[model samples]
Target chain A: MNITPNEYNEMAKKASPGTKSYKTIPAAFLVGGLICTLGQLLNNVYMDAGMSKDTASTVTSITLIFAAALLTGLNLYNKIAKFAGAGTLVPITGFSNGVVSPALEFKSEGYVLGLGAKLFVIAGPVIVYGITASAVYGVILYLFKLY
Target chain B: MSQRISKDTILLTNAPSILASAAVVGKKEGEGPLARHFDIIYDDTTLGEETWEKSESKMQKSAVEKALEKANLSSSEIQLLFAGDLLNQCISSSYGLRDFDIPFYGLYGACSTMTESLGLASLFADNGLLDYGVAVTSSHFCSAERQFRLPLEYGGQRPPTSQWTVTGSGAAIVGQSGKPPYVRGVTIGKIIDMGIKDINNMGAAMAPAAHNTIKTFLQDTNTRPEDYDLILTGDLGKVGSDLLIDLLKHDQIDLSGVHQDCGKLIYDLEAQDVHAGGSGCGCCASVLCSYILKRIQEGVLHNVLVIATGALMSTTSFQQGESIPGIAHLVYLSDSKGS
Candidate 1:
């Protein structure tokens, strides 16, 4: 069926059955609490698997990013975003989702430049700053140890 | 050129139904949607004026009546009627005001009509050329979308960057200085054309225009981001608003604290489903009339810079492979100054 722009706009004005919640405030709390619980579990699992504190944190980050990318690929992330509102955005997982979603979206434009770089446009600076700061801290620690 | 230009003062302001009904639609299939009331109503059954040729006059007449009621000035007392709309030949604004017996200055700024109209009217009012003048602009979703995008029945899913066209109208009256509220300063709008061709992606097209205009206004006026309580853009949707923020950051202009895009502020995402949000001349007009104007009157925001932007492209022109040339007009409103 050829739905027009006005028709599309009109249909959009209608509430979607998927995102509507009767007990919105409680639903928000529940969803947010569950996401946090999963994050805690992932942190424990990473430590139990023999990874150091820093390594476990990094591993959790990678795992969360991959999961978000998978959900984005399945078109489920957008749906969840609709339901959770800010809930989907509060966790480290949301940031991972943000980076991975755009990367996957631009995949069709080729891997070398499009998918590889455009995906990290918004979050790239944070990653760069993080690595640089960590390197500086590592150098400081080594010098202190020598003394 | 026809003479008889004089300064005038705005007696009243009206922006009824400019804000679309936040109808909880899917919840109830059929229910009388709540109304957003205003001072003037031209038609009991219809929204505003019927046809495009008659729309401008309808708006002008309604505005004149409202202004007259407030300022105690009759139709003959006003020297000129300055008005326009988002239409070819400005039929909606011009023809409707034809019977009002006043000189007319027809303007077309796509959606930037409100600011442009107010600016011109205020200039005349401030200069003492005319005693009272009325500036009006409007946009009908059915009329505008058909002219710019697809037909009303084309049910294509909106991209996350798309905006909804508002079916609304707004009118403001400016006169030769007034009490409490008056025209403080008018920032002349600068046109910025990024030469973006894809009308389907208005966010990319108009974002640059908005960024450029905001930058120029701040530079030319020597006003900083923190100068005004609100730095409102016309109709840049969610995507465009985000892009505009990034662009502004390049110039060391961060409006993150006190900036709001009119399109995004009017509707709720879950309720309206207006993907990127709302657009069109009506988006800014209705917003200006209903929300911003009300706040200005209530003394919530001390100073406001209303910047209305437009994607200057038609469907026929786009089909002919022409790019969308965007434009934006800026009007600074404050209670501190008189006309």
Candidate 2:
């Protein structure tokens, strides 16, 4: 895209480096932090539901993915995505949730080439590396035990 | 076409045509963020407008009332109402202004609404039919989020490139060549599509459109960078704003001393947690309502150009494998003396 010199001239004023109020700083920080805290609380809730550490982690992931998937489908998740800042992200659940939401969103286009394929558009590599790395790690641990 | 007075001109320039103007802020009530920002309180909470369908109507009516009060005009005096919003139906702007006593036109231009409204309003003003006209635009965090990415209660993280939609609305009243702050020059934006498909990153999607429009405006007007006091882009936040500077360098144009992206100017990325910046029509409009107009009142700026950028993509459009197409409009504000 190109811009004219006159347009550049018009934009110069009011373009100075400025500062926001001190009040807004803390409020945004607190709100964003609170959202993250809730994610941690959800993980704790899953742990106390009679699940082992490993199972609890899996359940948490599943819960995040499913909840995000539903919201993505209903077009509600994007609203929270706007506010709450990294609270909606940062968590491991955010990854799968991101992947599944986009895929499910495009599902109506047809399953074979659409749903099945697009489901991994963003995180396909992560899933691939995840299984591969876990298998390799398990073998290494077993060999150490044998030694 | 006589150069004399015109009825069409009166219909176009009047502020009575204003249907509605609504603002939705993200801050909880009584908690003012930017003291120097705008002269209004921010609403911090989830907003469910009874039904999503009625949201725009509710916002527009309220905004129009506020604008009318400020302009000291009545709705019956309006001949046409031009409005826009972030939603598909422009529900917040359209439905909000539906029952008004005037013809209605709806537009969707993402965050560059102030320029869009001014540009369109000026057209009617220049045409010599309208007397009073009003242009309004709006956005809401809760509404836009649910429609675009996640639910209000859904806990998800945003990438570094994501821009926060300013939860607010802004309205402007244009009349038949009256008063100090009047519509002056308008640069119609051309569609610039760079084939970028990631709707998640709007700055990249819109930077080219803004850059292209700015380039065109300068060429068409035969003006240089120094002619105006400032050149503003609609919503290209920090990352995209930097990229624009780099791109301008290639064109042998230096905007180092005079450039601002509304998204960047509206909020502090670190403080607001808006990664790239704020992207919404309100980003530009609110800043103008709060800052630029005040400066104009104070005579700090002589000539100003407001260019609003838009990412022409919807949730459905992006999901369908369509690349984002961008557009921008340029409106020039100058002194009546033309010096």
Candidate 3:
């Protein structure tokens, strides 16, 4: 009572329970590593089936995205993400879910405003920053080559 | 006549009685510990509705109907109805109760809608304005999640401090004449912000408000924690409840013995995967309408101080870097009238 905001914040911080990073970190690592390993296996399988390395890599990514979108539609991706923490998030599957979830959720609003507009709500920032950084890198590389 | 006891407390002289109450919840709540206490527990979260918003409205309607049925009165018999929900424009309450012919007042108290509406209803009944009034509020997990946080299927991890929004609704009928468990007094809370900005940790943001209201009520009533059988808080969850106990301890008022949080009571923390506990308007509303009221009616609990807390922050406000301002309204329910 009558305490400053800073004082109350300190008290609350001490009282509130924190996420157990020790458990979550390991879980994330394991699940994230497994996902990567699956991608590698899929790439190898595609290459062995006569596809080129680049095509196999592209196919692997498409397969993973499709799988993630399907899981999201089935409502299983979030449950796994809840347990796996950032493991599910730091992968292509997470990006797929980011697009698919909002698409499904906002479908009630309609095709244009709901699903079409809000399709990239979660993944929008990543795409924006990702393209921006790549474009900046490309311009720098071209300048160096010209010089 | 009802008298103003202190700065924000009002002592209801007429002592309006709670005629009947009902709680309706979704499948997850049906799996909770207090599941048996609830009147209707739908195994389907959608309740056969096409949309989650529609399902939430249906739940609220079901709760109101159940409460009216228990009171042996129809919606036409009720003079006024105060209802709200954790939705944009309080659509759940409006769309849910539109079919009813009763005069309706939609409130937006975030998670504290139940007690806010109940307090207003009790006040109106005590002042001889209405013969019967109903207070109802609701929250749906799917609806609240999509509106407040993220899409249901989004692959994001909830922090340990995050609470699950309850998919439930509760309604209570207060009459000028009924039985025990009368509405004795109410202590309206002032907004208290402790500068908590984390959307995930709403419990911490709201704990200060709960402390303020509970302290104010006790001071105004000249009573202590031991005076009441139970001092129930709305949707503070595990984190907020602990913080509330610690905050009260700073003032030499220990509440570890008699204090219970509706968030913690609704779900089995150990068994259920709910990180901190259950939250949302329905968290306390369903618990208060069912288990707490049932005990009070059965004479198991004579005196109870129900303090419903809420973090009054919207997604827009949070995005604009505003702290979550919290409020708690106290509604005193007891077996006998005060001296």
Report, for every candidate in turn, its global Cα lDDT versus the true structure.
0.62, 0.65, 0.94
Question: What share of the reference contacts is kept in model 2?
Answer: 0.18
After TM-score superposition, what is the CA distance of residue B67 in candidate 2 from its true location, in Å? Answer: 1.1
Best-first order by DockQ: 3, 2, 1
Best by TM-score: 3
Where does candidate 2 chain B have its weakest 10-residue lDDT segment?
A: B1-10
The digit string of per-residue lDDT tens for model 1 on A3-101 reads: 333442333233112223455545557766887787778889989999898888788778877776677677776577656655666666667666776
Candidate structures ordered by lDDT, highest first:
3, 2, 1
Per model, how much of the real contact set is kept?
0.00, 0.18, 0.87
TM-score of each: 0.60, 0.68, 0.98
Off by over 4 Å in 1: A1-147, B1-37, B40-64
lDDT of 1 by residue, B125-178 (tens): 666677667776666555565456533322123445567765556666666444
Better of 2 and 3 by TM-score: 3
How many angstroms is the interface RMSD of candidate 2?
A: 8.8
Docking quality of model 2: it rates as incorrect
